[model samples]
Target: MAKSITQEFVKGLWDEIPPFRLVLGLCPVLAVTKSVENGLGMGMAVVFVLVCSNMLVSLLRNIIPSKVRIACFIVIIATFVIVVELLMQAYTYSLFLKLGIFIPLIVVNCVVLGRAEAFAYKNGVVASIADGLGICVGFTLSLTALGALREVFGSGTFLGMSVFGPSFQPFTFMVEAPGAFVCLGLMLCMMNLAGNK
Candidate 1:
């Protein structure tokens, strides 16, 4: 009952999407998605960490003992998260500040560690890479969509450029904490409805 590499990769796009379909990694999805730029930045950092961690975990799956597997996986994931943090600070200082602690919190993101334990550890390196990439793509898309929706409604802008006319008043609620929950809930409902059809 083995799957082809293509199938493995494709599933993460929708069937196994991180936040929407899989319901993993919601903290950052709700926290830093006030703007599309922030969302994309966070998502890319996650993609880098997820892919790197998955590859390392798959590569060392045999050497790591069962009792210490989770510990080993954390170490591997933390290494990549630190790399992401330093790189972001060096290149994208503004975004690095905007994202703040959430960047470091990527170390505990269920999506990265979950994949390391669930998919990467059990699969070949190629399959693990595909899974990581697919999941990251799905996650990035979700974050961007949410960020765009919130940004447009909340500020009447997309990525900081005004989209609405001068007469249009922004919906401040969309960018607030309550708005995050509301937007996410409505989106989840839509997803569920579409999935049932």
Candidate 2:
């Protein structure tokens, strides 16, 4: 059975989202989502790495030995992650600082390596690229939503712009670590409930 390009593209959008569906790449999901800006930056970086790694892995799938495939894939993904990290440092230093260890940590993100080995290795370059793009978008949306929710409730702001005005008292817990878990759990529950409906 052949998988169409559309199938590859759409699957990641909802079916195999890094955080919600697959449950992969949760560390960054919980960490840098303090603000919408940080979440967007991190999501974009992950997308870049996933697309590049998937494309490269698909291209090299035939030649790479099964035994060393994991190492090769990791190296390829890490290279792109580094490129994104350096670019962020050069241009968006403040956002990069907010992202901190999570930026470099993209190298170890299972979603990147998982797609490379699971889909890229077995599919054509076009399909692999489509899959990567879909997954990246899914990840971006989920993270950004979480970030927006947290930022708005925690500090009464959205992306640093005040949303609730001076009268609204901010909830300090919404921006903290515990808030992340609560937000994520609630979001996941909402997503599941929506899907069931």
Candidate 3:
């Protein structure tokens, strides 16, 4: 039986979310999520790489030998990641600076390889594209949510604007690694509560 394009597509949004659900691609999730802008840039870059790699992988699935599929997929993903890296450097130097090495590290994001192996190889271009988009958006949302929370508490800002009153002081720890973990933990708890309800 063929997989429904809907299932292939929608699963990534929540059921197989890149970070929380699948637990794939945690480095950038943890590293660049200090600010909403950084998280958004990182997420968009991953989306570009993921979509392009999935498309390429789906397009070539039939031609590549199964024995070498993983290597081929990695190569394809790396190519797109490099393209994204150069594009970011050319067009968005500031965001590029914010994203830094995390952009190049897209090459190793498990979400890219996981989708290629799990969905793209077995599915057609359309379904694979949906899967890629869904996962990327899911990832973007997760990172942005975390980044925004951290920014608000840690810097008293929302996406860089000061949200708190002049009398309020910011918490420095929220922008650090421990802060990311704490925020993520709280988000997970909220998600779990929502799920049960």
Q: What's each prediction's TM-score?
A: 0.98, 0.97, 0.95
Q: Report the lDDT of model 2 for residue 59.
A: 96
User: lDDT of each prediction vs. the true structure?
Assistant: 0.93, 0.92, 0.88
The residue ranges of model 1 lying beyond 4 angstroms of the native Cα positions read none
Say which candidate scores most in lDDT: 1
C-alpha RMSD of each candidate structure in angstroms: 0.8, 0.9, 1.3
* lDDT-best of 2 and 3: 2
Choose 1 or 2, whichever is better by TM-score.
Answer: 1
Over 19-116, each residue of candidate 1 has an lDDT whose tens digit, in order, gives: 98888889999999999999999999999999999999999989999899999999999999999999999999999999999999999899999999
Q: Which ten residues in a row have the lowest lDDT in candidate 1?
A: 1-10
Query: Which parts of model 2 have CA positions greater than 4 angstroms off?
Result: none
Best first by TM-score, ranked: 1, 2, 3
Number of the candidate with higher lDDT, 1 or 3: 1
Question: Per-residue CA lDDT of candidate 3, range 170-189, in tens?
Answer: 89999988988888888888
